[model samples]
Target: MIVADLSSRELRRRLSDDGLYLHSGPFICRIQSVLAKVADGLALAYADYPLADADYADFHLRLAAPRLRRWISPQVQFHADVRQPFLPLPQQQAYAMFEWGLNWCVSQHANQYLILHAAVLEKNGRALVLPGHSGAGKSTLCAGLVYGGGWRLLSDELTLIRPADGLIQALPRPVSLKNASIEVIKQLAPGAIFTPTVMDTSKGSVAHAKPPSDSIVRQQECARLAWVAFPRYRAGAALNTQTVSVPQLLMRLAEQAFNYSLHGQDGFSTLLNWAQSAQAFEFEYSDLPQAIAYFEQLASQPHTQLQHEAAPV
Candidate 1:
C-alpha cells in the first residue's frame, strides 16, 4: 500500500505506536513522529511512495518533543537509532528537520553505492547529473526541468551510482527549495504541490516541492549516466557553457562526492569510468527559461561532441 492509502488517523497512530516503514527508492526508512507538521508533510509530499514491511528497515528515525522543554520554548529532537545527531530545532520546523535529518541518515550510512551531493534527472533513458555547491541553482534547474521541461526526477539531493553497472539508482523525493527559489518554482509549475513555507530556520525560509507522481512510481528504474553539468546561476548573466575534460571533471566530482575516500581505489575507479564515458560541461546562466531551453535542445540532439579544454588541476 502507498502512503496515500492510509487515513490521517491511522497514519498518526502508526507514528505514535510502532512506526511507519516508508520505501524511498532503494532504502526503507522506518519513521516515528507525533508532530502534525511531519504527518502533514508526509501526506502531501510522499503520498505516492510505497509502504515497506516492518521486518527490517535501512534506517530507524523519530522526531519527538523534549521532556522538560516540551511546554517552554518548545522544540523537536531527531532520534536515529538511539542517537540524536542534531540539536533540537523549533517545533514549528519539525517537518523541515525531518527532511534534513533523513538526508543526513542516507548520506552518512548508505555507503553501498557511490553517493554524490547532486541533483539528477532522466530523459530518454539518459541521466543528467547536476553537481554544484549551495546556491548554485542545481535544485532550481532540476525543479524547472522536472516540473516545466518534462524530465523525470531521479533525485533532488543525493545521486546514487551503482558501482557494478555504473547506472544511477533512482531516489526520487521531494525537491527542497530555499528562499527566493520557492516562489520561482511556484511560478514555473503553478500546479505543483508544495509544503507551507516555514520561515526563520537555518537556510532562510525553506520549503519542499513534492516530486511528480511519475517519478515516485518509477523509483526503482535506473538510468544511464549521459551528462555531468556543473550549473551556476548569476543575475543578468548570459548563458555560457563549455566542455570539461575527463580529468578535470573527475577531480571536481570527487570533491562533490560524500564518501569518495571511503571506497578508496574502487571509488576512484568507479568515478573515473563514469567520467570517461559521459560528457561533462560547465554551464552558467541567469534566466531559468533560457537554461531550460538550452537543456531541452541538448536532449533533442542525437550526438554532441563539443571541444574539451584542459584546465589547471
Candidate 2:
C-alpha cells in the first residue's frame, strides 16, 4: 500500500511563464517536480500515479503542516518560497536545485543523517555511493551496478548523509536519467522501470527509474558510507583511480552540495570526516564494463577499506 500526504498550492491567477509544478509526498519532504508547459507545449502530467495515493501540490493543508522550519538545520538554513516574486522561464535549473535543496534540508533532520552528492548501490556485503558532478558518469555507472552487478540502487541522484555521525542514510528515491544515459541503461538493463519521458527541459527529454524494490521494501535500512568514488566519463581514459585529494575532493563536492555550506563549518567538517572515513577515489574511464570490474576488484581485498592515514613526508 502506498502511503501519502501533501500541501497547499499557492497559485498566481496569471499563468506562470513556464508553468512549473513541484509536489512533495507527505512521506517524503523533497519536492517531486515536472515543468507543466514547454516551449512547444509538450506537457508532463502526474495525474495517473502508479501507487495507492499519489502526491499533489496541496500537502500543507493537512491539519498538521510540516514543521518546515524545524526541518531546516542551522547549517542548512536558506529561503525558497513561492510567495517570493516569479522569475523567468526554463525553470529546470533553479527548480532542480529547489527540489533537491528542500530534500537536503528535510533529510538532515532525520535521525542520524548526512546528505551526499552520490549514487548509492548495494553489492555483496556493502553499499557504494558514487558522488560527482554533472558530467560524471554516476547514473550510467549506477545503472550497470543495479542491472549487471547485482546491486540494489538507493538513488541515481542524491544519497542522504548524516552529519552528527558519518552514516550514509538511505533516502531511496527514483533514479533520474538524462539523454544518452537513458538509452545506454535501457539497453544494458532491460527490466528497469522508467517513468514517462518529460521532454523539452534544460536537460532535454528526461525520465526517472522506479526505485529498486529492495529500497522500497527495506525503506528504513540505512547504508553506511562505504565507497565514495568521484567518477568522470573521459572519452577513452585508461580505467584507473586518479586519487582525488581530500581537500580538493571536498572542494568539488562542496560546490555541488545543496547544504554543504548550509551546514557551514559543520557541513565542511562533516564532509571532511566522511572523506577521511571512506575509500575516496576519482575514477576516470569510458568503458562501463571495466569500471564494474574495478569495483569488483576493490571489493575483494582484505581490510579493503581506504581510510585516510597521515600524509607521508
* Number of the predicted model whose lDDT against the real structure is largest: 1
TM-score of 2: 0.66
- The residue ranges of model 1 lying beyond 4 angstroms of the native Cα positions read 303-313
Model 2 segments more than 4 A misplaced: 3-114, 307-313
> Model 2, 179-242: lDDT tens per residue?
8888887887788766556567566767666655565665556666667787889887888786
Candidate 2 at residue 300, lDDT? 64
Q: How many residue pairs clash in all the candidates, one count each?
A: 0, 17
Compute the lDDT for candidate 2: 0.55
lDDT of each: 0.91, 0.55
lDDT of 1 by residue, 1-313 (tens): 9999999999999888899998999999999998899999999999999999988998999999998897898999999988899999999899999999999999999898999999999988888999999999999999999999989999999999888888999999899999999999999899999999999998899999999999999999999988999999999999999999888989998999999999888888889878877899999998998899989988888855544453332
Query: Could you estimate the TM-score for every candidate?
Result: 0.96, 0.66
What's the distance in Å from true for residue 196, model 2?
2.3
